[model samples]
Target: MFALMQSTRTQSLHLTVDAATGLKAVIAIHSDRVGPALGGCRYLAYPDDESAMIDAIRLAQGMSYKAALAGLPLGGGKAVIIRNPHVENRAALFEAFGRFIESLEGRYITAIDSGTSTVDMDCIALSTQHVTSTTAAGDPSPHTAMGVFAGIRATSMARLGSDNLEGLRVAVQGLGNVGYALAEQLHAAGAELLVSDYDSGRVQLAMEQFGAHPVASEALISTPCDIFAPCGLGSILNCQSVNQLRCAAVAGSANNQLTNLQAADQLEARGILYAPDYIINSGGLIYVALKHRGEDLGTITAHLARIPLRLTEVFAHAQAEKRSPARVAESLAERLVYQKGV
Candidate 1:
C-alpha cells in the first residue's frame, strides 16, 4: 500500500490464522543489511488496516536504526497483531503467530514491545525457540529506564548546560513499566515529577510512590517543566504538540516520537532541544543484543554508559553543522551502515 511505502523502506509480510474468527498480523522487516531483523511484537487496536500497516513498517525501520546506533549485530523488524489482546481468543492467536514466525527460518526475530509483555513473549516462545525476551535473564524496563535517564542527563548537559537534576520539573507522559521506572530514576536524581497516564491505576500508583502530581494526558504537553519525557507511544511530538511544549529538552523511550521527519525541524525551530528518539532510546535494544550474544553484564552496563558519550557527539554535530538533531543522528547511522557494507 502507498501508506506503508511512505512510512518505511522495509518488506512487508502478512500472516493470518483461521482458528480465530479473523486474525491478522503484519511483520515489517526494515533492513537486514547488518543482520537478520530483530525487534518487538506490539499489539494494539489500530484505527484501520492501513494505519496498522503503516505503523508496523515505520516501527520496523526505527528498530533497524535503534539496533545499528547501539552497535547491535541484528537489524530491524516489527510485528503487530491487529486486534485487541483483551478480546476473545487472544492466546490462541498469539500461538498462531508463533508458528508464522517459525516459518520465517530465522530471517526475523520477535521480542516484547509496548502492547506485548515478557510473559506474552514467553507464550510465543512456546511454538518457536527463535524468540528473545528481556525477562529471560531479568526485566529490561529498568535497564531501559536507566538508559533514558542517562540520555536525559546528557541532553540536559548539552542543551540547557546543567547536570544537576535537583528540583527540575519533569513531565512523564506515560506510566507503563518503562515510564514508571523513568519516573523513579528522575525522582532518585532529585527531579520534581509531574506525571500523567490514561490508566488511572498507574497514575495513582505513581502519585503514591513518588509524590508526583497527576495531570490529564492531553494537558501534559503544556505543563511547566524543564523536561518532557514521552514514554507512552510514538508520534506524540507532532505539529500540534510542538507549539505547546514549555520544556527546555525533549527526551524519552518512545521510538519515532516525531510523527514525521519535519516535526524534528519544528522542534529545533521552537528552541526546544530534541533528542532523536532512536538515538536516545536504543538502550533496550543494546541490552537485548548483549544478552543475545551471551555477553557479560558488565559489558552491557559499560556499553549503556557510552550512550551519553554518543549523544554528546550527536548534539555537537547538530550544533556545529547547524542542522536538525535528527538529521545529524541519521547521518551517523548511515555512516555506520555504509562502513559495515565496506
Candidate 2:
C-alpha cells in the first residue's frame, strides 16, 4: 500500500471504521498543491480491503489530473466506503462517514460518485459542510454528459475531419445516468446508436427511445463504429480489450479508462484516436467545484463549454509530440499539479 502511494505520489491516506454503523471507509488525498483536494465519494462493495484502498488512491490521482487540466484552482482526493450488505441503516452509515469527512477539516471535499447519490451527499452534508451534489446542489450527471458530448464532437473533428454525427455509427457502452444522457444527445444529432449494458432494461429503453441497436456487452468493444463511448467503470481499456476495439475513436465520461499507460500507446499504434478520460470527463468536477463556490448555472454551463477546447489542445500537443493524447495529458496535468514546468 505504501509502495502504491509512493509510486502515485499520493500525499496521505485516512482509514476509519465505525463498528456501530458498519462504516469502513478510505479517503486518499493525492495532491493539494493548487488548493484543497476535492472529489466525489464512492460507495461500493470490494473484494477486499486492499482493493478498496487501491481504488481510492487511483481515483484520487485521476481527480487531481482532472482538476488540473480543467484549469480549476483545486487539487485531488477521493473517498471510498466499503459497502456492508449487512448494515441495517444506510443513513446512519453515511452520516458516520460524514463525520469522518468532517474530521479531515478542509483538506478534502466530497461529492457524488458511482454507487453513491445526491441523497447520500445530503446525508453527508448533515454532518459536514464539505459535501456537494446534495439534493440542493443538484446532480452533476447531465453536466458530465454535456461535456462528453462536446468532447466527442471535437474528437470527431480531429480524427474524421468533421464534427457532424449525422448517420455516424456510435457504440455506447454502459447505460448509467451519464451514458444514457450522452446517448440521448448523440441520437438527437442523428447518430445511429449501438448500445450495450449489463442491465437489460436500460438496453430496451435505449432501443425504444433512440432506435438503438443492442449489442452484447462482451462484444461491444469489438463492434465496428465511428466512435465508442464508455460511460461505465474504469480499467475497461487494457491490453486484451484494446486489441479488440473496432472504432475510429474512443471517448466518454469514464475516469481512468486505460488500465495502464501502455494501453494509450496501443490505441495510437492501431490508429485509434484516444481522448484522455480525465480530460474529456471533467465536466462533473467542473460543475461541482464551481457550484460549491456558489456560482450560478450559467457560469457552470460556460465552464463546461471549455471541455472541447482543452481536449483539442491535448490532441494538438499529442500530434506534435508523436505520442498518445493520454500520455500528453498526463504530462500536462503533472506539470500543473506538481508545478514541474510552471
Candidate 3:
C-alpha cells in the first residue's frame, strides 16, 4: 500500500488483514505536527488496494488542511476498510478494525464518513475510546451543511453583493446525507434549488419536500444558478469542469473539490468565487474533533460559528488581492498547521 503513495511524504500507512472476517483495511496518517491525528473511517469497495491507499492518503491530507483551517488542535489521518459490509462478517470485522485503531495508541483517531456510520463507530468504540461523532453529537452531516451554508452566504456576499439566499438559484449536486441537509437549508433560506443525485429516491424526496427542481447528474455543472454545490466526491472540479460551471460561486461539503491549484485559477479567471472545499467542509471534522475533546453542545455550536467568519475573511482577502480564495485559505491553513503544530 505504501508503494502506491511512492513519492509522497506520508507519515504512516498501516494495513491490517483478518482472513476470518475478510477484512482488508488501510490507515493513513498525513501529519501530527499540529496535534494528534483525527479523521473518519470509510468502508467502501475499491477497484484495488492501491486505489484504497491513494484514497486514504488524499483524505488524510485533506483532514490536516481541514483541521488547521477550523482551528482544531488535530492533525490529519484516515482509515479505509475495503469490504462489502453486506456480504462480510461485519460485526467481527469492525471489531478487528477497532483493535487496529486501538493499537495506534491514540496517534490516530476516527469517527465516521462515506460508507461508515455511527453504529460502526459503536463497534469500534468497543475496542477503543478514540471514536466520536456518536452518542450526544450524533451525525455530523447537519453541522457540515450548516458550515457550507455559511460559506455559500459568504460567497454570495463577496461575489453577488448580497448574503441573503432568498430567491437565489443554487444547484446542489449529490443527494447524500449531507447534500440533503444542505438542500433543505437552501430551501429554508428561500433559494430556488436545482438538485441532482445518483439515487433517484433522494431526488424525488428533495423535489417533494424542498420544491427543488431536478437536473440530470451529468448536466449539473452547466446548470445556470447562483452557486454550484458539489456535495459528493472530490476532484470533480477540474480544468475542464471549472469553465463549464455556470454559477457565480462554488461552495459545498465535498472535500478536495479542486483537481489542483490550477482549478482554482480557472474559476478565478472565469470570475467565479470558490469557497475552498477544506475550509467549507471542515464542519464535520470540527464537530467530531470537538466531541473528542469532550466539549459540550453549546461549545461546539460556538466553535462552528467561526466557520462563516473564517470564510468571510478569506473572501475579503481574495477580493482585496484579486486572487483565488482557495489559495488564500490554503495559506491560512498552512500557517495554522505550522503554528499550532509548534
Candidate 4:
C-alpha cells in the first residue's frame, strides 16, 4: 500500500535558486484526466527538502481526485516554493516561480493554496499569464465554506436524518479563511459554533465577527459538538485524535485528514460519520477548474451544488458495504476516471 501510495508521487519539474540563498521550487503534476492539471502554489518554510516534496506530491495527487470527483475537465498539479516567505527574497522567489510556470507553457496552471494568497498570486501573475487570479472577486474561502455548509446539510440528511442545522452545535478547528466562512454559514443557520486557531488574531476575529465561543487549540476536537471541522491542517483525524473526538460527524476542508487507511476504518467502527476530505473539500478545485476553462460563476455554482448529492452517495455506499468513507470515495473517483480512460 505504501509503495502504491508513493507511486502517486510523480517526478516533478524542479528549479533551484542561484542566489546566495538556497531555495528549491517544484511543480508536481499528478494527472490530466479531464484537462490540463490545475492546483495552487504554496510558499512556506518546510523543515527539510523531503517534507516539501512529500507535501507537493501528496497535494497534487489529492487534486487529481478532487477534480475528478468534482466532475471538472482538469487534472491535478501543485507547486511548492522553498524558503519561509516571511524571510525570503520575495521578488526573486516569486519571479522564479513565475518563470517556472512560464516554462510549463500551459501544461500546468498555478493558483493559490495553503500558504499562497491572492496577493502572492498577483506576484506570480506578473511573470506568467498562465497563473489564475480569480482572487479579484474576493477570497474563495467563503464560497468554499458555502459548499461545505451545503455538504454538511446533505451529509446530515443522508447520515443523521436531519435536514436543518438550526440547533446543531459545530466545533470548527482552525479559524482560517474557509473556517471563518463556515462559521458565518453556521451562524446564519442558527447553529451554535465553537472555533479555535493557532493564531490568536484569527481566534479573536472568529469571536468578534460571529460571536463564536473560542476554545484552546488542544480542546477543539473533544468539544462535544455535532460536527468536528478540522480546517487547519492535515492528519489531525488519525488514531489518537479519533479516540478523542466527541462529535457526531467529521467534515472539514483540510486535506489528507486520515493519516492512513486504518484510521479511516477505525472511524467507521466507532460509528463516527466520516465525510472524506477529497470529496467534501472539493469546492476550491471546482472553482479553479471553472476559472481555468473561462466558465462563468453561475456554471460553477451549479456544479458546486452537486457536492451534497455526491456525499449522499458515498455515505450510503459506506453504510451498506461496511467500508470506510475514504475508500469508497477514492474507489468511486477512480472508477469515473478509469471509465473515461484518463
lDDT of each: 0.83, 0.93, 0.87, 0.80
lDDT digits (tens) for residues 1-342 of candidate 1 = 755654455655555555563458888787776688888888888888878877888888788777878877778888988875456766667777888899888878887788877777777777787677735755567778889999999988987789789889999999898999999999989999999999999999988989999999989999889999999998898888898999899999887899876888888887888888888887787877677778889999999998888889999989988888888988888677557751
* Residue 324 in model 1: lDDT: 80
Q: What residue runs in model 1 are displaced by over 4 Å at the alpha carbon?
A: 2-7, 338-342
The residue pairs in collision within model 1 are none
TM-score for each candidate, following the candidate numbering? 0.94, 0.98, 0.95, 0.93
Candidate 2 regions exceeding 4 Å error are 340-342
Clashes of each: 0, 0, 0, 0
User: In model 4, which runs have C-alpha deviations exceeding 4 angstroms?
Assistant: 1-6, 9-15, 18-23, 85-88, 134-138
Best-performing candidate as measured by lDDT: 2
Question: Distance (Å) between predicted and true CA of 33, model 1?
Answer: 3.1
lDDT of 3 at 144: 91
Which sequence of candidate numbers ranks them by lDDT, best first? Answer: 2, 3, 1, 4
**Any runs in candidate 3 off by more than 4 Å, and if so which?**
1-9
Write one digit per residue (lDDT tens) for candidate 4, span 19-40.
Answer: 5334478777777645777888
Greater-lDDT candidate between 1 and 3: 3
* Decoy 3 TM-score against native: 0.95
Candidate 3 per-residue lDDT, tens place, 1-342, comes to: 555455444688998998777889999998876578998888989998888989999888788888888878788999999976365567788888989999998889988898888888888888888888765558998889988888888878888989999999999999998999999989999999999999999999999999999999999999899899999988889999987888888988887788789999889999998998888887888888887788888998898889888889998998899889999988887677766652
